[model samples]
Target: MAGSCAPWVGSAYLFLQSTCKAIALPSLYENSQKKPSVFRALKLALADSTGSVNGVDMLKVHCSHPHLIVQLKFCKQENCRHFLRSYREGALREALQNHLQLSLAITAVPLEMELKAGNEHLDSMLKDEDRCLEYIYREKPDRLRDEEITELEERLKGLMIHQSTSNSIPVNDCTSLDSPSLPCPSQGSSLSPQVTFIFQGQQFANRTLTPDDHQKFAKLVSKKWKQVGRSLQKSCRALRDPVIDSLALEYDREGLYEQAYQLLRKFIESEGTKATIARLVAALEENGLISLAEELLGLHSNEDCS
Candidate 1:
């Protein structure tokens, strides 16, 4: 009976050991695969968190220094404190000199409470000084203090005096053509009539037109038309008669008579009344499109009669 029991016990132990090995193998494999990936990610995060300020890795310094300081501050373990102190003091000093500048690196641990509060009063006073400086240099006259106003006024007076002196050209000096006695080209040329067009509130004349003037003017008109069209389209509505009329006028100014006529015709078809037709006719006649204007007028008269 003892021999039989011993053999049975040995077999049971062998079975248990095999089952434990089967269970433990996968977990060990998984841990081996997972641990390296976790370590790599942690390494990447640490690398990214480190910021270079004055060519120093601030995050690494911040992390490592705190750990060392905490060990020194607490000093619970005698061996730990001694090792940390010795390492910090000099063990890697020569190697770390290039990476950490003495003036910029944290040499001592700061009290947590003091660091939290900072120098609030000093910061407040500096902010106040900045505000005062901004007030003195303020562009808005209404915001200026009395002293600032007086200083600015004196500066302006000095500027005006300097300008007056510099601008005073002698009449006898032939080289100084900016004198009052010297006639300006525009004033001199005003004796003769000049062909001029006013487009977008700016005056353009034949004399001022360069060789590429027509192309430049056409490009400008195209740009303006595109801008106006975009604005009208964005409003999600049909273009108004006045906008069409303005565009027609711009096209006419650019010598795009066909485009101008087409725009006017579309305006007339959509929004023209008797008064609008009259205005259109006057505009067309003024722009030397008499035949077109007469045709419009005739159409209007026929409509009115009908």
Candidate 2:
């Protein structure tokens, strides 16, 4: 499950992985002529899995070109459509290497697809590893204003409390970095953690992005930062949109921004301001990074949103 995510199609055998890679047979015919027939069978299998009859019109997959953007066109239904899923070379390799009877791993594109055609980026990546990485690191833009913390004394005075004991509210004990547990409210307790909220009698944490969140996120992305970074750099050039590019993660090292986690954590932290979790989710969506965003939010998008 580490390398896998929800189907590209809301409903299963599909999101990023071409059911073609589920090429259940390890003895897949290397003969070029036979590949098409196999894909047709795969197309049918995918339709069955997704509960659609004749859904996929075309399923093009090549074992050799594992890095070429993965795509499938389903028989259009109401508004059901298909998309180009770009995978990191690593994910594609894993998909190919997988001989699991019923599983395949795939990575999804984390950028706007309409950028200078998929082929262009592929050609650049295929042609020159040294050449493409010469991107000039732009100035990291800062936009959000930091919220000022009000002193407890000021708040106590503002409330006009004349209690003999200190009126200051104790800080929530939930910010413990040592343990990654979310704030859970104790039942029947008079006081709930400051960060806890009750909804329909169920207590949940009003989680915010924190340094610990950054560390956790960094650990998750650290393994494949290069692949993720490469995709980000290429898309940034195409977007030229100042806002997203500014918040985009840096692949190459720059001071504390040396790792993928640092770059991504910096992105989430908003330069130490009161970081809004929505901002990170919005930025990822704008960049067409549905999978990563979903992962952060602890979800698999079941609704098929075009």
Candidate 3:
């Protein structure tokens, strides 16, 4: 009876242990299955529906059907992490290549040729008289280089000369030319304020100026530039307006060295503009900023350090 009882007890314990093991294993599997796919960890490969994952011996994604299931058991047994990584990289490269090929096929264009075609279209649009002014206005500043500006100025000057010659007449009406009572600007006399304003307006419309007007503009621009620059410099703080600083730098680098130098000098000498003071240091490059701008940046850094 003791022996029979012993055997029964051992069998009961073994059955219970087996049942527990089975239950625990399923829970572990469930947890693993619940794990979200890590985009960085998983590998990808391309294979036809009929293709076998034979010899790859890695994360064998047998594309037998549309529902591509990974053979988890095979991957685990093979210790295929390295292989899978390489496979994924290769797959990615191939995918990129295929994409580029498809894009090219759809467009049927080489990049250089495409750019040339676009430039041709832009030229065609610019040729239309009604559209030319709009096109010029819409052009990006960077695209309007010094050469383009110079060319436009020359063209405007030519237009102004042509208009003046065509409109000039010897006699009578106020609307027609040559009314001695209707005073026009001459070398001997100072223009009235209204006449000066009108001339300025005409220059703006034409986007061209006479030599005297150009000199006056250059002086005015230089003065204003210096005023702004000095104010920024005296702030003892960082610059706030990156756009202004960027413009200043561009002007300096692109043949306006004198303007750049003067502006930087003024910024140092004058009390800084409150609006622009805080932004100076971070946006302006350390090496690129003038001595005064550098000093201002130093003040900011010191404040930050404190």
Candidate 4:
């Protein structure tokens, strides 16, 4: 009779357990549906209009969530980090494509704490610096401290002169008649005007000519001059009388001695412009500035003395 009562007691216990589960299941499902997963919450916060918090910071705060903490503790997840990385990269790529019309070549998105690749943002920001000047001035005054402001003023002054340096001036090459004291011929050229900044006695212009740039310019000018000379030589039948005289005088001032001599030798045999050429020869003899005089003579026989 006692053994028969044991079955009834066990059935009653099972019925209570089923009843509790039935009561709890709906609330559990509802809560699961209503609450965002840890990853979703992090993404939503990142998409906030303020653009204040980067994704990595959101993840830090999210670790306090019980579900996420439990998952982290138990889940032997090697690939979990990939989820956040891919999401960040996708978002950055989308922004670049839709807004910037740029395609970054980034395979793995770096953490927010890490430095950016290529410093790509710097170029973008500099392009917009003028448009965003007021914002920067008001919000980021540290960018223009008193010392910085003074430096900017000095740069403006340098730009006003259309500043050229000894390196950039091309010695006596007269292709461009610009000097440190004088304004350049192309005043409105996009590259001519520059603002320089001084830091620790070092100077940097907005667009100073480097050694490579000078070398390239010199090569180009020399090539063009040679081509013109060759064409003139080929049609020597027409290069006589008034044409040759006019050419001689024009280049005598411009300082192309070899060119002038080549042309004058055809007609005069003795170039009456000996005085002009003599000055260049004397300057060259000094050797202190042989290249300068040579370049000057190439433009104007008397340019070295001038």
Candidate 5:
């Protein structure tokens, strides 16, 4: 009877232990079902700690099929926490709908360490447009839509046109030969003073300055000045600091120094300052064309003396 009682007692003790474990252990399936709510709480806790959260750090979006695929990274516990709250609050879905015009589908999938590494590599490559383009062409040529391709092509065309226009040298306008003839005036006369200058390698004889002639000259100078100003502005805007140096070197290489000289002369005449001349000289020197820069400066000095 003692032996039979001992066996029964042992069996009862085992059953009680099993029942306790069943009540104490959490169910993984149930936790998964409540993931959105759990994540939301986690996110709020993280937000409270970090003081701020960025949406980009929480989610990554891509187009895999007709549907948009959103990848959530939880490498950082704070990011994961914030993302959970955002997901629960439906902010993530709303953002996707607004930006990509796509509907959301929530699905739970196993996360792999390798997948996270691959995503990081892809993000780095995308920072460089050429590399990103090459990657797309090699790995996912069909990823981009026809409309997206067309839009990109149009943008490239517009950029090329803008660059060409900005770098182009303005051609001298010789449309009108209807310059008014005015009598040459004495040097001390307040009415009009004689003026002579070389333009496009053509030397204009000394002629009396009248209001009409002054107006015409002023218009011509103002137009050319504006062209130069625009070119400089564009170069600065595009962050092309070496543009002037390149232009000067190209002109010298092509034996078009006379044209370059004439352009500089017009700039000086219009601006009427030594600073413009100094800038031209400095540009040529920076491009390893010190001789050309010196010659240009010499001509400016000779003109001053004359």
Candidate 6:
């Protein structure tokens, strides 16, 4: 209180009293020595994490676009807008954007009220992402075809990129492993040592994907790696014991996507370096996945072409 502004301190004290009372956490109030320091900490947290003493509609968005409503239990975004490092779960954010075609937000939380709220609402949150992927893979009556969604998503993405700041590459934004991925037909990524595919009539044709595309491609493979590994095994076994196999590409998968996404992300770093669209296609063909091969190529182009 010696160096702090008196009026601001008094206001913060009252805010904390109300918030602490609402939270109903005995330890928070009982710790008398820490009350001032805790008040200061909450003040900083309110600034950084968007917690307001006065009830602000922190989760309401000022939008009328076609959408669904979602109420998040953990309202971590700055007043629940853009993602914050405090949560460090941007992958979930990207997954909703990429897979579910859903925009995620904080959902009308007043922030402090949820500090020690009941666990009932916590169950509503998306904890296990893998459990819900059946919606994508498994059939549904009203579900639109992947091709239609892909094309529509592409158009929307083009519009979004056009409206975005030129200072940053949209591709440099969060990459979703849950996002569909993999190759184009005819031309190859062979023009550059690091590239594995190319689009002849697209904006990114001249750009080099190299190391960036490598990681993305590898993660795509590893995402459905059980399937990829099985297909590779089939292709390898088709030759009645080939000289090399996906087993040859065996890796630790302990970094990058592996660390960021804590799924069964097993891969070797060199797999991306060694991979080619042609080689993957050949393997798929050997395993009699010609249609799947086409889909992979198609999705891959959709990724980098626009």
Better of 5 and 6 by TM-score: 6
Model 2 scores a C-alpha lDDT of: 0.32
Per-prediction TM-score: 0.14, 0.29, 0.14, 0.14, 0.17, 0.25
How well is each residue in 150-258 modelled by candidate 6, as lDDT tens digits?
Answer: 4443454453354322222223222333322222222453332332222211112112224443444443322233344445444233322231233233334453344
CA displacement after TM-score superposition, residue 30 of candidate 3 (Å) = 61
Q: Specify the poorest-scoring 10-residue window by lDDT in model 5.
A: 9-18
**Candidate 4, superposed: residue stretches over 4 Å from native:** 1-130, 143-306
On lDDT, the stronger of 4 and 6 is: 6
TM-score quality measure for candidate 6 = 0.25
Clashes of each: 0, 3, 11, 7, 2, 6
Which residue window of length 10 is worst by lDDT in model 4?
Answer: 9-18
For candidate 2, write residues 200-280 as lDDT tens digits: 122334445666446534533333443443444332332233433343444443522246565555444342332333334
RMSD of each: 36.6, 20.8, 33.9, 31.3, 30.3, 19.7
Residue 253, model 5, lDDT: 50
Q: Which is the winner by TM-score between candidate 2 and candidate 6?
A: 2
Q: What is the TM-score (0 to 1) of candidate 5?
A: 0.17
Q: Tell me the spans in candidate 1 whose CA falls farther than 4 Å from its real position.
A: 1-258, 269-276, 295-306
Q: Tens digits of per-residue lDDT for model 3 on 1-306?
A: 124333111000000011222223123212323111110011111111001122122122222221222222211212222223323234222322222222222222111100011122322342343342233223222221234224433443454455434433332122212221123332444322222111111211111123333232232222234344434444434334663566566676554435545344434333322223222321222212221222232211111101
Number of clashing pairs, model 4? 7
Query: What is the TM-score of candidate 3?
Result: 0.14
Q: Give the Cα-based TM-score of candidate 1 against the true structure.
A: 0.14
* All candidates in order of lDDT, best leading: 2, 5, 6, 3, 4, 1
